[model samples]
Target chain A: MPDPALPRRVRVHEVGPRDGLQNEAAVLPVEIKAEFIHRLAGAGLDTVEATSFVHPRWVPQLADAERLYPMVADLVDRGVRLPVLVPNARGLDRALGLGVREIAVFAAVTESFARANLNRTVAESLALFEPVVARARAEGLRVRGYLSMCFGDFEEGPVDPARVVGVCRRLEDMGCSELSLGDTIGTATPGHVARLLTDLHAAGIGPDRLAVHFHDTYGQALANTLTALRHGVTTVDASAGGLGGCPYARSATGNLATEDLLWMLDGLGIETGVDLRRLAATSDWMAEHLGRPGPSRALRALTHRDTPTPQDKEP
Target chain B: MPDPALPRRVRVHEVGPRDGLQNEAAVLPVEIKAEFIHRLAGAGLDTVEATSFVHPRWVPQLADAERLYPMVADLVDRGVRLPVLVPNARGLDRALGLGVREIAVFAAVTESFARANLNRTVAESLALFEPVVARARAEGLRVRGYLSMCFGDFEEGPVDPARVVGVCRRLEDMGCSELSLGDTIGTATPGHVARLLTDLHAAGIGPDRLAVHFHDTYGQALANTLTALRHGVTTVDASAGGLGGCPYARSATGNLATEDLLWMLDGLGIETGVDLRRLAATSDWMAEHLGRPGPSRALRALTHRDTPTPQDKEP
Candidate 1:
């Protein structure tokens, strides 16, 4: 039981601007994207995955990353650590040239997902990421590894927990500071997660070294996160308005909604340092700008059909 | 960890027609409600909570429970276990008159919610239920306990986990065959559930003595359920199209979406005796009928777009 006296806090990593926007057909303007991140930062999120450094042909949604990076230079100028996704050494070089201080590298756990998503075999993908992590570490930049399809895959029957552990071990050895397991296809259950994390923990993986990335595709991400937490995993990846999807995974929803996650944390006596009401407003604004429905249920239920009071309209 | 050989099977107790409808605004016609229950049963849900026996003034949606019971003779004739909600002695008396074989009784974990929702204190609610359970047992009827706000409540924040354990123990002592802990306001985080269940376990509450009832209000129900599973919880309460909400708590979302739960369970190598494609179709039908969007992301995504066929749709 939590000591009723001790203050509880949780860190929420915002992946909307990168993981969220990457899969949307609507290409937001670089300024809008920058403003989006700016708005998210103002909401009290500590770390936000800002953009990806992949070639335009690979992910055109972030082709404006170069322009967007300079637009948000004010954040870096203020010492906020905004990380960018780097696909390979070339992507890493591009990010470095842009004066990025932190980078994220990802590889799929299952061979099918890796081939479908990254156009490479599992081993080949990890091999490609090895030097990128080393280069980033050598340059004094923090490195985070994403292991996608950690639970289930579309084409693959079932992702082996052992394979995920193996991938995580490799990433850690390559100097990846944190390992974020991704349920790319959104096919995870709490039971699968509990069993897998038990194995992951027994395999010498510590909670501090792990983060969880879940899609709401199966509505089990939050539950899976809790299962991971039972074994000591803390850091979680969420998207504002619950935005983002896997490009290769059809019918997949966005990452676990950030507003929803914050609500739970807030109620649990776990402080997320997020102004949930403000986060709801941010989600609403983005939904309006994107011409799509704001996906967060908490945001919709809290803000819609209700007039804002003076305190709500202040910012 | 799981012997890597045994199959994981989850038993889903669909409460949409009974627990769900009892909390909705729409007063669905008896025929429509019957159709809804029939559809859920057709989707491979072996246990469907059918209706509730409560005063019309209290729950207008389930006011016609007595009338709806006879309409489901087709289900009873087919040997489907259709359980109905009974609020108190009077409700139980009415259910018995209808020849109901199974009934569910509910009490809140927090006194505030009990008083607000049921106009009684937790003790008063349980006291009122003593005769109901006693009589049900005399009638050879199966009884289940619905522990509302087991995680948290709107008026009473952070319910004492011990209080929850105490109420559950009392209900079990009263012959409740299955005890369901509800996240009535959906304010539970994975960490919170981990702590709560851990406390319950320490208090000698076994997983077999518990069922998990979660809401997606904060989108952590699945995660919270996963936390329960980590502690060995098997039975879960879900609503079709995520149909259900708290009349007292205006913005609280419905119970965990049944189709979404089934999808994750299917993926986890868990046998739920539920069909994913049929569940998705049922949700689609119900969503259209209700003129509202289905809250199950898995069902929505599955029906909304084309999906690449999984190698094995069933384990």
Candidate 2:
């Protein structure tokens, strides 16, 4: 039975192709990236973040976004929402030219990260995204605003929820339909997650328009996600096979593994249209391509067994 | 800030030496095992499960329990709780001979695991533990009952919560002071955890007498632990550096990592009296001794950094 405090159904926003790969050291061929997105959609993920339209110099791992977009266009026609990340107007134009119906804009909630990442202050970055968001909305595209470092920053320490709320309000006012709150450092606990959601609700930003993107850097992602679900936020962002690593923190672990999230969701009897076995196989296959084991416990447990005999039972 | 619904402090039952090593392929020397316990205690783990008195043939990894206990007996003098596992009257005798103050008896909630593990029916295993618990308590030793396969069984599938409550009641009535609920196969979710705790509470088994031993096989350990904490469970079982793996499941991951759990508890401002960096370093040290990397995200993130330059920030 589902917990009465949680939503009966959750939409898992698959970000493996884009967010997962962008942080990886290896750059895959465009065809492989397109196939990965298709496989994710085939496994019942309705929305898959395809790739980022950022400049090649910034993210060479996803440089083939234009080519990759066309390869998975059939899935887009079949009603899978393949949203790509757009940093600014130039990236927005690139996504629009590919007939993209949905796009996400990234923003830093900390001034340290904004200056380090975007070469601008937090206010300057938001101002830059304003016109890009407005133009995306004008073109009838759904815009998702990703607010990173919403929980903690390495340089500045714990971020204030009020500061995060201000940025969220600005993004919402700029016509962004959804906000994906990123715990980039993966340092947020359940109490902090509850407090943030409570503050957001008090500021008129309800759970209906919120998605939680938690990293497992400190192994708090799933627990934090559970707290968010209890607060009525249903959409969760997870990478396939726990693919992404934080470049800033130099941490091997990254986003919460989708398989791990599904294990909990499936056990709770909550509806998440994705098939666990098929998804684990996809991740295991991807791990082989990457020449390393996937970081997901569930994926490894499901796919790599040690030939258990009856006598091997724990005593 | 701590969540108002959760406990203010938690007792971390360090199970690295006993439950962890029992499943590991590499059996450390008695000296190393004793030193590991000392390191764990030095890192602020007040309760460290030393080793099991199970037969050498059945568990060769912990065969040197006799030699190990005396080496760490000074910790008991220092007011640290060092519990050992005793399988039966014979095991209890061995523990009592060493002047052990606390011992744990293992039981299974499902018939399949009871037969496979203890080579007896569930009732027969409980019947065997009856004398063990009675004798230990008669000798003024604190007896803990470890009920495994509480959430799932590979052969039988999802075990009923009512069945688990029945075993728990039996254990409590047989002079056991505490019961450690083990999700040996790691298939439980938050709702299942909440439901099982509620059922146990209704059955008059309160959280004070209950501890949770969750495995991270499916990566739901911490989330389920959070639910348990919200339900007022104060004691949590974890392995340092995620030292153990389930022999039955043939999975690499095992008990919830002490470092990972510490990260969450510390972030939530709940007191566990553990030094995160010290505990993580101990795990890393143990991993080197065992010739494998520890399966802890927080430990890896803290110790295995890629050397972050200022320009390596995530965008």
Candidate 3:
């Protein structure tokens, strides 16, 4: 049975094609990236972040975003929500030209992360995103504001929830329909998650307008996500096969695997509309293309047994 | 800050030497196992489970239990609790001969697991453990009962919490002072954990006398553990560096890494008495001895950045 404290259903925001592939060292072909997004949607993911429209110099791995967008246009026409990331007005224009209906703007919650990741201070990055978000909203596009480093920063010890609330309020005021709170360093704990959600609620930013994007760097992603769900946040951001890693955190792991999240949701009797087997197969196929096993324990457990020979000798 | 609903402090039951190494393919020398235990104790693990006294043929990796226990007996002298696993009366006799202060007996919550793991029916295994637990307690040794497959079984489907409560009552009635609920297959989720604990509590088994042993096969270990902690379970079972895997399950991963558990507990502001860096360094050292990277994400994130070169290309 589902926990009474949790939502009855959750929307999994699939970010494998965009957030996931962006950090990958191997630049997958545009066709492969398009196919991956298609497979994820086929596996019952309603919303798939297709790719980022960031400059090629900044993210060479996703340089083919312009080409990739048109390839998966059929899925978007079929009612699959393909939300692409737009860094600024230039990226927004690129996304708009492709007839994109949804887009996300990335912002850093801390000055250190803002300077390191965006090459701008917190205020400067938000200032840059304001016009992009306004323009996207004006075009009848759903804008999602991604607030990175909401939980903690590597350079700064512990993040203040008040600081996160302030940024969230600014993003909400800027007309972003949803806010995906990012634990970029993945150093968040359950209590920390609870405190942040509580603070956000106090700031009039309820769970209905918020989503959680967690990294598994310290193995706290799923636990933190659970805490968020208990607080009535229904949307969770996960990468297929645990694909993405944080570039700033020196030894960061990938985002929480969709398979792992599905296992927990399925066990809880919560509805996710995801087929675990099909999703694991997609991740397994992707793992082969990457020439390395995905870091997701669920993906490994579900698919590894089918392989004739075990990869690791430990188990 | 610690969650008000969770426990203030947790007792970590270190199971690397016994449960972890027993599943490893490599058989380390007795001295290395003893030194591993010493280092774990030195890293602030007060209750380290020593080697198992099961038959050498069944668990050859931990076959050096006899030689190993005496080498780390100094830890016992230093007020550290070093409990070893004893399968039956014969195993109990071996532990008793070595002046072991505490020993744990293994049982299964499901009939399928009982037959598969112990090669005996549920009743037969309990019948066998009766005398062992009685004898150990009669000798003034603290006896712990390990009930495996408390969540789901590989052959059987979802296990009834009432059925688990029955086995737990039997174990407690058999003179066992504590019961460690083992999700051997790692298929459990947070709600299931809360339900099992609630059912056990209804059967008069409180969290103080219960410990949780979760595997990371499905990556739900830490999340399920957080639920257990919220339910007031104070003792958690974890292995250093995630050293073990299930021999029965086709692709089961290792136990919840002690380093990962430490990361969560430390982040929650719950006192565990463990130094995270020291514990991770110890796991990293053991990974070298095992010739594989440890499965602990916290261990990897904390120590991997220190190495000059990156190991995996994904991140």
Reference-based lDDT, each prediction: 0.78, 0.87, 0.87
- Candidate order (lDDT): 2, 3, 1
Clashing pairs in 1: A222-B223, A223-B222, A223-B223, B8-B270, B9-B271
Q: Local error of candidate 3 at A210, Å?
A: 0.7
Candidate 3, B115: how far from true, in Å?
A: 1.6
Question: Which digits, one per residue and each the tens of the lDDT, describe model 1 over residues B195-310?
Answer: 76777789888777788898877676776775577568888888887887666766676788887777666656677878878877877877776778767777676776567535
What is candidate 2's local distance difference test score?
0.87
Worst 10 residues of 3 chain B by lDDT: B306-315
Sorting all predicted structures by DockQ, with the top scorer first, yields: 2, 3, 1
Winning model by DockQ: 2
User: Which regions of candidate 3 are displaced past 4 Å?
Assistant: A306-315, B306-315
CAPRI class of candidate 2: acceptable
Candidate 3 chain A, run of 10 with poorest lDDT: A306-315
Error of 1 at A52 (Å): 2.1
